[model samples]
Target: MIERLENVVTFLDKYIAWMFVLVAVILFILLYLTYQCCLKYCARNLSKRDKPRHYRSSTLQYIRFTQVVKTPPRLSTDSHYQTIPLPNY
Candidate 1:
């Protein structure tokens, strides 16, 4: 089992190294950009500065799914044994 784990780790080490390298490169780029923007802010280079230097990017978007909204499920209760809902009037 230890040998198998070592073999798996060795195999995954290459992929993990590359992943870390990619993440490091991306972080370095972002940090450099932020540094440059900070320098510009300190130097007062721009004429108008309404917006922020770094814009936060969204990772996910809110979306509405019709299937989840339009349908209703049935359920049973121990006392009533039938699900009851108010009329949608």
Candidate 2:
């Protein structure tokens, strides 16, 4: 058991630098994606901070009018989650 452990440790020691680089790249991608998502959500939520226009009607709207154009979902997760629209028979 000790010999097997030593061999595993030796293999990792040889590849430690590669593992570190791979982990760093994955973490950077995840952090960048999270930052982008947050920025999108914030931009969508934030409203005007400056002066109002001559008419506020253009700037103001009711919540009921918000519409999102969602793309079609994949086959697997779609079955588990929301039901996807089907073509007419």
Q: Which candidate is the best by lDDT?
A: 2
Q: Listing every candidate in turn, what is its Cα RMSD in Å to the true structure after a full C-alpha superposition?
A: 22.2, 18.1
lDDT by residue (tens digit), candidate 2, 1-89:
99999999999887997899999999999999999999987775564332234323553332212211144544676357655454322
Give the CA lDDT, 0 to 100, for residue 76 in model 2.
72
Clashing pairs in model 1?
A: none
RMSD of 1: 22.2
TM-scores, all candidates, are 0.39, 0.41
In terms of TM-score, how similar is model 1 to the real structure? 0.39
lDDT of 1 by residue, 24-80 (tens): 999999999999999988767452342233321221211122233334745765564
Measured by TM-score, how close is model 2 to the native structure?
A: 0.41
